[model samples]
Target: MTAALHGLLTGLTLIIAIGSQNVFVLRQGLRREHVLAVVLVCLASDVVLISAGASGLGALLRAAPQVVAAARWAGVAFLLGYAVLAARRALRGDGGGMEADARGTRTGRGAAVLTALALTWLNPHVYLDTVLLLGSVAASHGEQARLFALGAIGGSALWFTALGFGARRLGTFLRRPRAWRILDGAVAVTMLLVAGMLAAG
Candidate 1:
């Protein structure tokens, strides 16, 4: 129980930090587009990553700096591209809620899922957090590492569920074009910052 609780707290501490994945999930939720799918991908991803970490894949990752570097560069490129799109959206400002229009179109399910995957898999920080930091912590639990991982996975499940579904309550506020502009602006800035940080690191 102690291990599980520790894992839960640690996972929450890492996962609750605002990042590209969370931002995408929140946006999809607000748009009411493939929320279930996106949330599931995120959860499933956490399951695999957390499990891999607990099972000692973290050690392999540490030995492979090249792998980390590849992911880092990929993430920088992806984030930069996404940030540009978001910036354009902010500039266009012809927004309606979750529809395909001249300014922007609602993405299809496949696109959403692919995005969820890219945002989840491409970010090197995800690896450092889940596979490195969390794994090292779980390893300290010795035989109870699995339980610790379970607790961490539980934290991920709870957070993504709330972040995705709970965003609907803000629909009223987000319906305005200006609200979307503000959101896109914020998203653009956040993406740029993340990319910059990843590059600098």
Candidate 2:
């Protein structure tokens, strides 16, 4: 119920953060290259991670308030730092930003899948967002924690499916580097707002 919706909203907020994984997915979607495989891999990984966080790991962290505080601070730091980077990307048109590796020659299905895996598993923030933050929130939900987790999973499915498939429509507009700057600006704002929320909690 409420937990489910909370999970869904939280999940969307975190997943929508512009990052390597997201950019990669958007690029693949635009190229219409192995979209199904990329989407499936991302969705499956989220299921496992979100379940692990909501089911138990979150509770463990809850038992340790100090640890949760530390994570909260770390998240704030990461979010602020990321926001700065995103702003710079928008202003400077940094080639090393999200679109840096986005435009190279397309890889085979296997490579694309592997890249998706790497992008998901390699990022440290994934753990922070899924296992720590989401888990911690679900733990706070008490009896309805499972519902929260499921809702988060639903968010993940909804976002990835839309990003992977719907991005094709935006392919024309995103071709302009200014559109990317605007995208980065929006992401920066989202990150700042989320960071503010985390810091306040």
Tell me the whole-model lDDT of each prediction, alpha carbons only: 0.91, 0.78
Q: Residue 108: error of model 1 in Å?
A: 0.3
lDDT of 2 by residue, 42-124 (tens): 99999998999988775675567676576567667766776787788679765222344576534589988986886676455
TM-score of 1: 0.95
TM for candidate 2 is: 0.65
**Per-model TM against the reference:** 0.95, 0.65
Indicate the residue-level lDDT of 77 in model 2.
77
Model 1 misplaced regions, further than 4 Å: 98-104
By TM-score, who's the top model here? 1
Candidate 1 lDDT tens digits, 54-109: 99999999999889899999999999999999999899974445554444577889
Output candidate 2 Cα RMSD.
6.4
